[model samples]
Target: MNEEDLSVLDTVDILDSPLDAIELSEPDSATSPPDPEEMLLLLEHPESTQRIVAARAFCELKDERAIPHLINLLQDVCPLTRVSAAYALGRNPSPVALAPLISLLQQDWNGYVRKGVVWALGNSQDTLALKPLIKALKTDISAVRLWSASSIVQIAQLEYESVVSAIPPLIEALRRDAIAPVRSNCAWAVGQLCRELPLNVVYATAIDALIEALAEDQDLGVKEDAKLALLRVGDPRGLKMIEELEQEGWI
Candidate 1:
């Protein structure tokens, strides 16, 4: 073939190449974050993966306008979509999302979905979530109980009185929960609940419970957590117990 004909053929061959084999140039400016409206539309897409991506975009945008749409996704048929929506709502930090998240935590059948709701409640730091989270601490699922205890601690850190009612439930979990981590978390939560209160103002019942856990809990981790909780609450008993445990090499 003549040189001109060969050059023309090469160009034609390049044009015929499969699209997937070509590398596209990056845009001059970084691709703009998905528009909130576009993200909302994605949430309604039939594909669960699309909905999850949309939910995650909403989380990153942290736009209050997307809160209502994200809340609706909490009930999406796909568990992953529900989880992402719960997470977006939590990170969005709107009081409007609080009740919906609590509802999901209580009603969602999937442990993964409930786990997301528990985390969302903790991130929200809303006092309104206190009662629901306390109830969650007693749930049959260990993952639920673990997250519930952590959420209670988060609430307690933000506002101790809001979680005061949780103290009894926490004590119950510490003493009676079947899971060792749940008991350990409850101990940590009890310490957090009373961390800011004066020694004399602390709940005697809660303090006594921590002392008992320190002395008698079978899980070494639980005892260690209880010991820290007692010390945080200014209980002398915890110090004495720690010293004794150290002497016995139980610490």
Candidate 2:
């Protein structure tokens, strides 16, 4: 991962601005961070605009009280409302929202809504998120697939067994994902997961993937990320490959 602690692996960042569709308009710039109790009321307001603003408010609010309301809005007729609500649930992250979030991710037609849902599921850090996230990494649209790689890292931090489960998909994505950034994310995730694993088949497999990318990937950015992953994991095989590649003037 990067030099910033936990950010590379643990943070669920949306590179593309999915929120651009529902930017919050602060009613009053004067109030230092608005009132959640009042925002909660607005959450169910009749107007779709009101609901969008209210849902977006909870994105910064993090009040657990908004969890159920946000979950309800997951099915909103408006894609913008549903997307905002998904993001708010990500900020709040209640277990109650997990199944609903997963449901939305699987069935929602809007890519932005599904992207937000993927982010919430990742931030929730629930084991149940692992399978869906893996599916997203493998099968979703590029934007969603990008977040899925990083989110898998978020869950893998919880346990060793989870790390074991996470590595294969990550390695698979790194080796074959068509998008360069998605593959780069998989590389970063693989390196971060390696920190949790002992020297074993899983560990060796991860190192092998990184080395392969470092040597063979077409994108220079992807190659640099793979090189960084190898350096971070500090596997002998990876370190040796870097050395040989440097000696041969290939890196």
Candidate 3:
């Protein structure tokens, strides 16, 4: 339609109905198109709401085109926005997203942001993330440590031998971490790793942890994970321990 004819229809429609009644369709190209300039501007917006919304919009756009702007947003003063930016970058998982995420994993003050970095690292599946992820597994926050453990699992899934090299640390983590989830993940990753490594490397330590978890952990799921890990690792001695616990009426 001609602009004048469209204008006439717009005027008539406005006259006939309230603005809320007019179904204004969003521009088709506006849905997920990259807008680096707008994203950059939003990064400096005084309102966290605008900054977070813009960061989320950029993520939903899935534009490698916005990598630079998104990277800059990784340091946003608002923890919420920084986390949103981290997540957006993670979802993109471009090479451009890698350096910034690694940097964030090292230095970001928020555990949530670091968790996002863990996810980004897993998405990239870069072996370079191994040491950093291992270090992050020691983070005080349960959420951060959980992702770090999962990233280790992801790496294990790819480089089974290299992951076996991670076994001592994983065993130590299960041996020591205070968090139930971290210990639980440590148990699970060890079970998966045992399938790939010489069973001797993981069998004793993992079986001990799983047996303890099955018997002593307060969370039933954690106990169940321990049971399952024992099954996967398949130690006859571990089963004997469970039977001993049952005989003692400890189960």
- Ten consecutive residues with minimal summed lDDT in candidate 3? 15-24
Per-residue lDDT over 1-251 for candidate 1, one digit per residue giving the tens place of the 0 to 100 score = 23233233223123221211111223236578668878878878888899888887766666777788888899898877888788777668788888888888878776656767887898887888888888888863676677689888887667656656677888899999977877888898888777655555357677888888888889888988888887776667667877887799876
Best by TM-score: 2
The sequence of per-residue lDDT tens digits that candidate 2 reaches over residues 137-177 is 99887778888888899987798889999999999999998
Instruction: Rank by lDDT, highest first.
Output: 2, 1, 3
Off-target runs (Cα >4 Å) in candidate 2 are: 1-15, 20-31
In candidate 3, the residue pairs with backbone N, CA or C atoms under 3 Å apart (3 or more residues apart, or in different chains) clash, namely none
CA lDDT of each prediction against the hidden true structure: 0.75, 0.86, 0.68
Quote the positional error of residue 116 for candidate 1 in Å: 1.0
Residue lDDT tens for model 3, 146-236:
6677778777667766675667777777767766667778878877776675556355665666677788777666666777777776778
TM-score of 1: 0.78
Candidate 3 TM-score versus the reference: 0.70
Q: Could you tell me the lDDT of residue 222 within candidate 3?
A: 67
